[model samples]
Target: MNQQFEHDDDIEPASKSQLKRESEELQALGEKLIPLDRKQLESLNLPDKLFEALLEAKRLKAHGAIARHKQFIGKLMRQVDPAPIHALLDKLAGVSDTHNAWLHGLERQRDRLLNDPKALEALIGEHPDLDVQQLRQLIRNAQKEKASLGTPKPLPMKAYRELFKLLKQFNPEPPIPGVLRSDDDDFDADE
Candidate 1:
């Protein structure tokens, strides 16, 4: 019994450095919450006092005031469960592997459209809701920009960016719970 007790005592508690690291993480999470719109912030279900403190922090323009408020928010965070908050933030920030893969798929489609003229027809066929004329014009502009670039000069990506925005707007919605997505889905094959 004595030897067992001594063995248990040999294990050290978390170090001050570890505790400081945890505190800093909490502060960083609090700072992220500050930039979120009021509706999104409320969705996190933060403690009432912490939410008010965050709103106050958002209103503070002075550096010292903002710093102090941030510290207060961090302190309040210690009193609440942070796991759910972290999950919500991760979802909102598109930090999940699945969300990142979806974004990458969008990039691939954009690249395909830029490189292949037939891709425009295929995309239009897939998404009939998209304005065919507008897409054609954008593709023409993007191809022209790509061809006109001088040696060592980068192509202006304005049309490319616009095409991405349009694709996202018309991208098929991910199937909800209990409804499995079919492989035949037009956009986001990984979904």
Candidate 2:
């Protein structure tokens, strides 16, 4: 009976290598958090002390200091339950993907408008709120800028950019369901 009890006690815990890998994984997750803007980082709802430490890490210029701060963040991360953080990050990633798809749709619409006159009529039919005359003028200028094929002058992107802005005004992406959007979503509006 004593021997059986001793054998039960001898069942080993996770090995040192496994522990090290877990620590490294946590550190890598912390690294990913570094590049997020202030509002997005705030949305993670991190513990206040840990959040301050991360902000400090962002300000650290020296390579050694940044590395040390990252290790400290990894240590802090181990103390918190990371499931909620993971969920928020995943939700934010999905929002980013949706925003990119919307931008691509706008780009395709702009190209169609520039290439085909009938595309303008189709757009106005679909989005009656858009000003047909303004769209026509912008399309004409964009086409003229594109035609500088044999000149030494560089292509002017002003009209192309203006068309994108106008399209955004006409149709904006609907908010993602159940997700609190961060202000950083507008960071790429100009692009």
Candidate 3:
């Protein structure tokens, strides 16, 4: 009896219901994996068969086909341990860390604009919806304040803070679902 199991032979085989629950959990895990990019999937170090199956699953789109393929993934999952895979997924999804790296990137951009005149054009190119005049003013103000102070250290001036706030509003990352203050769908009226 113990010979049938890999981890522990003393433990009895799981009941049918418990087995079914595990299968469903693995299927759910596969569903999450489907949305991840190829690079992320490759980083998992999963068994080759499972990796190929996942790639196929991602390539599939038809509803019935996807349903059947997901079942196949669940079967494949049974042959593998899920703990390490799940830990990697959590790290990629920013579940384990504060995920503040994007914020730091934004700050770097802000500083770049302050230092280089050409940076404004690049920023505008990336965010076409930006109010160029307002941003130019903020940059000018921030620059003046920086030049006025003899200290080499950066200061938290009003314009510098305002620029960051404005930049934050146009963050490229999709906002978390259900985070809106109102379910208004951003309805706006034209003049």
- The model with the greatest lDDT is 2
TM-score of 2: 0.63
**Least accurate stretch of 10 residues (summed lDDT) in model 1?**
182-191
What is the TM-score of each predicted model, taking all chains together? Answer: 0.59, 0.63, 0.47
- Given candidate 3, what's the lDDT at residue 175? 30
Candidate 3 ranges beyond 4 A from true positions: 1-11, 97-191
Candidate 1 residue lDDT tens string, 53-142? 888888999998889889889888887777766655555566756556667888888789988878888988888888888988888887
TM-score computed on alpha carbons, candidate 1:
0.59
Q: Which lDDT tens digits does candidate 2 get at residues 43-119?
A: 66778988888888889999999999999999888876665566556555655666678888999999999998898
Q: 1 or 3, which is superior by lDDT?
A: 1
Q: Rate the local accuracy (lDDT) of all candidates.
A: 0.73, 0.78, 0.72
lDDT per residue as tens, model 3, 63-162? 9999999998888888877776675565455563322454666788889999998999998998898999999999999997777678776565889878
- Provide the clash count, candidate 1: 0
Off by over 4 Å in 1: 1-24, 35-45, 60-68, 79-100, 151-156, 172-191
lDDT of 3: 0.72
